[model samples]
Target: MKEIVKFSFISILFILGINIVSFSQSPNESSLGIQIEKNPEFRDVELYELKITQVFKIGNQGKDSIVLKAPTTMQIQSPQLGLKIDTIIGVSRYKVAQNQLIIYFSKDKIYDFEIFYSYFGNVANLNLIGGNLGSFYYWDANEEFWYFRSTNTKINEISISYPNNFYLLESFSNSKDIISEGTNKETFISRSIQNIPLQFILLNKLKYERKRVVKSNQYLYIYLPIDSTRNLYLNKNNIVKKIESQFDKVICFFDEVTSRNIDVIQIDYNKKGRALGNQIICDSSFFYTHHLLHEFIHVYSEIRTVKNDSGYFFLEESLTEFLAICLNYNSKNRDIYFDRKIAYYSNKSHANKSIFEVDKNSNENWDLIYGKTPFIIHLLSLRLNENEIYRILKDFYIHYSKKEVTFDDFSLFLRNQSVDKEVFSEFIRLL
Candidate 1:
């Protein structure tokens, strides 16, 4: 099955080209329309490869030319063999840019175009079934949402067709937005959701498993692949206990909790750690580590800060890491972690650079964000107790939960945190 998947994917890689079918129509008033059709197919469910056929209908009803920038692939992970443009109708010309298709339409014409493309989406987490006879594949389609730019382009609808046996596990869409759900297909109509993106998860239920644990204020869902079910079952009790304990600690430190459903999906792919909203997707190996806790803290500490803001990485990533380490480890281990981080940062070229100088867009500044910023927080924790640190953080969270904040705002908040002026000034100098 795996070999078949690989062969099919490889064969599709070389089939890239535009098959243009041209037609003409009378020009009309300026307007644009969009409709998307998505078909996800799995020749063998045991393999992680999913073949997706995406058909886009773009109607340009204008007297002038227009250019549209359409994304080639929506998933964060690039397509295995790039997208193949199987068919194109009513397009003057198109060229591939970096992960985008710059399509051109001629002036004084009406074009009702259709673009059919296929790409292999390898975003699924593997679940072996019946000792490798078959497998169940699951993945979140959160990043599968389409993004295109055009003036006054109205999306008609998006239709998704999957295997009849596949299940729509979860979605962030309103139930009313789901226009139709037949045996093998689902359609979502874009009524007033022009600004919101659709998010969903799909899974094959043959060997997939999920556990839901409801606490007093929070609901947790743990999704495990079939191969890991035995180990998960054995550790289920301890897992729940530890999660609850961590939740309590976080709530206690923050003095508040957001009552929402959190999904922790154990993915098979290496280096797949991601935390968005209340969802935590990570490799199975990091499930019980502080890394997971770091992601968890992000949910509670998320602020509406822009990437251009000074110390944006410090406020988001570093502070979250500091709190996660504090909650997950004792003083001894925490000290060791901070010492290692300090050592790493000390060797970096930007060791002496202030946290305010870290650019969120530059990969080179990541060490400062992850190492020096957290160590700075650790140093502050030494001058003031952890409880005091949590109090200040709790106050900061309250002030900027859903509001935009900058490093200057945070620095000011810390300076006013009722700590000793000399100690606070010393900590401010570290940043």
Candidate 2:
């Protein structure tokens, strides 16, 4: 009777155009019978506003009808950033959610649809930008079209049409991706990458200047605003000297040489600095050496940690900041910085929360993660000498460089290392 009931339930699900088996697979895994080809076009590109049109060709290859839930909006929130859907075509019966569109399709049927939308206000500030007039545009292709768990999606091509007066100074993209430059319009094609999102950067020839420097055999690309006063030029030289002094220290400590060229763009943004892939976006007003070194360390020791996992902030931000200060500052300055961080964390109301409980997205928990967590790492370094701690971190980086690592995986790796059991237990207890 139980087996018969289970079979009937599955039959009902199939009749309702639902695939039960696909739910168990990974979010990016191929669905049972759904395939999607996407083409996105950006036009009327300006500093603060742009229009985007995306076309999707979806096909079903199974014997049963399927319900497709396609994301129809970009997940961005800003009072100044307004997103308006201008047009939609190719589907008559569809329901719209906050950021998703749901539609029903018949078996073996192919459907082509298009969505036109407009984005306004600080659009170029999505990653980072500097100067009075925006000089660069950064786009994360994946976030625009989020993961569809029940579909095999491929980005076929992308088109960007900018103003005629602005020339394409420099463009950056993944090696597998290709950009065909044109007078006012550019075409981007992805050769083999699927599901993985690629980042693209477009620089304006008139507003930005690029400098390429080779330090210790590693290439560094510095993009700065076109300044007539030569102040930025002098600052650029100072930045190179700082990098020259810190590059060997990072390599020696990590015991790894990152072959990829690093791009540092001086930008005016709310945040002090941020590292995306191999690019460092530093705020022009607050370009301190320690802050740049922190972002630099992020590029060198980049890890593929499971997103939003427990202790994610601890591993990504806390550890990087701790290592940056260790490598950048002298003993006295390091002690002062560590003491200040300890004091700041002690005063926070959320200081009682464990590192595992801190959320990266919550602004309230920022101090706990950035302040308390680093001090905790400092404590561990004290228990086991700094050299041993660095060795463990190096091993962790080598083992999990390109793999998705979870908090438990990190904890287990640390526990398996040859450390004192009592000290390790105390450290884990503190976290």
State the displacement of the C-alpha of residue 397, model 1, in Å, after optimal TM-score superposition: 2.6
Which pairs, if any, clash in model 2? Answer: none
lDDT (CA) for every model shown? Answer: 0.57, 0.57
In the range 183-284, model 2's lDDT, one tens digit per residue, is 666554544233244344556557667777775556677776665235754476765566556665666666655444667776555555767666776665
lDDT of 1 by residue, 176-251 (tens): 5665567756665554232234344455555446777776676777765555544653365566566666666666
Which segments of candidate 1 are over 4 A away from where they belong? 1-67, 72-161, 164-201, 229-234, 247-259, 268-272, 276-278, 329-357, 360-367, 418-421
* Candidate 1 residue pairs that clash: none
Candidate 2 lDDT (Cα, 0 to 1): 0.57
- Candidate 2 TM-score, C-alpha based: 0.68
Rate residue 57 of model 1 by lDDT: 38
Alpha-carbon shift of residue 94 in model 1 (angstroms): 10
Residue 232 alpha-carbon offset, candidate 2, angstroms: 9.5
| TM-scores for candidates 1 onward, in order | 0.64, 0.68
